[model samples]
Target: MRTVDKTYVIKGKPETQWLLVDATDQNLGRLATKIAAYLLGKHKPTYTPGVPMGDYVVVINASRVRVHESRPETKIYYRHSMYPGGLKAISLRDMLQKHPDRVIRQAVWGMLPKNKLGRRLIKRLKIYAGQEHPHQAQNPQPVA
Candidate 1:
């Protein structure tokens, strides 16, 4: 008799959880990495690739996320339209003032898989500029 190893595959929907994170005074890169891990479900032992086994992450006070003092001036975000002379640029300080939620979103997005799965995973991340969020009904546990 020949023994063969069978790969373990998760059947049905994998269990998921809701995690709440407070961004107050949290480092931007560190916070984004943690959020990306939870969104990718790497924190779970049953993590399976190509499966949407991640958690619903709710981040509050995104505006309070911190970075190095010089980062605001040195870091510049840029985007260019397909058309000529259509480039747009914004500084980190300006981005924080305009869209604080995007700061965290873009950072975390960079850490996720840039594919269909990545798109779907990003939807589970809910970011709020202030301390309040509407996901309280989900009874999400604080993830520290």
Candidate 2:
């Protein structure tokens, strides 16, 4: 008979890997979904939702991310300043032109758990508008 260690448990301090993803020409929703999964360690066999088990994700060419809509301008991102009549809305086109990185960041953020832990997990994501990034020291592998 084989004996197994029932009390054995893995810690949240899993070995983190660096993943490089090119956002160029990729659909916004699809790319965000994949990145969110990676951030939450969903791809790992030892994934525990309560534990912060994930890797660093570096995204490049975020400015070139595409949308499925024929007119992406119809998409709206809303925000509130928590003041009287502080509601504001920004179109996708404007967001892409003004701050492209925010587009991907917001998308991934929404997919993550809405809690303090989620906020901490999101910090692992690094987004760049262009192809250049300073995380080359990590030698991140291309995420296909």
Candidate 3:
């Protein structure tokens, strides 16, 4: 009897592609989760653990991302400046109005691995408050 090995291995560098996501009328959590997956290469068959095999993600209309109807006023995001009495809290409504990009960025950031790899993956995410983005040259494919 002869034993044969048939496992396939991915070599060379990973080909990074640009992905576009529209946040219009989409649930905040769901959209972020999908974006996070793409950032971590979880959607690819060649996924490798501890490897940043993901692609770039461009999010447009981030200001339109949907949250619970009543969450805007009740939901609070907190931040600390590492100093006494430095804790600050902002409501979802305010956050959306002031920095819509941060809303999605923070959401996706939470879903990625808490390590250097995660940091690198996050840098690929580009967000826009409207439907205009500068990555048109990359011809990013629209994603749900």
Highest TM-score among the candidates is held by which one? 1
True-structure lDDT of candidate 1: 0.94
Writing each residue's lDDT as its tens digit, candidate 2 over 7-67 gives 4347646888999999999999999999999999989988776677889999999999998
- Candidate 3, residues 1-144, lDDT tens digits: the string is 999975544688898999999999999999999999999998999988788889999999999999998999998999999999999999999999999999999999999999999999999999999989999999999886
Selected candidate, larger TM-score, 2 vs 3: 3
Clashes of 3: 0
Compared with the true structure, what per-residue lDDT tens digits does model 1 show for residues 2-83?
9998766798988888999999999999999999999999898888887888999999999999999999999999999979
**Which of 1 and 2 is ahead in lDDT?**
1
The local lDDT score (0 to 100) that residue 51 gets in candidate 2 is: 78
* Candidate 3 global TM-score: 0.91
User: TM-score: which is higher, 1 or 3?
Assistant: 1
Task: Give the runs in model 1 whose Cα sits over 4 Å from its true position.
Answer: 1-6
Q: How many Å off is the CA of 134 in candidate 1?
A: 1.3
lDDT of 2: 0.92
Estimate every model's Cα lDDT from 0 to 1.
0.94, 0.92, 0.94
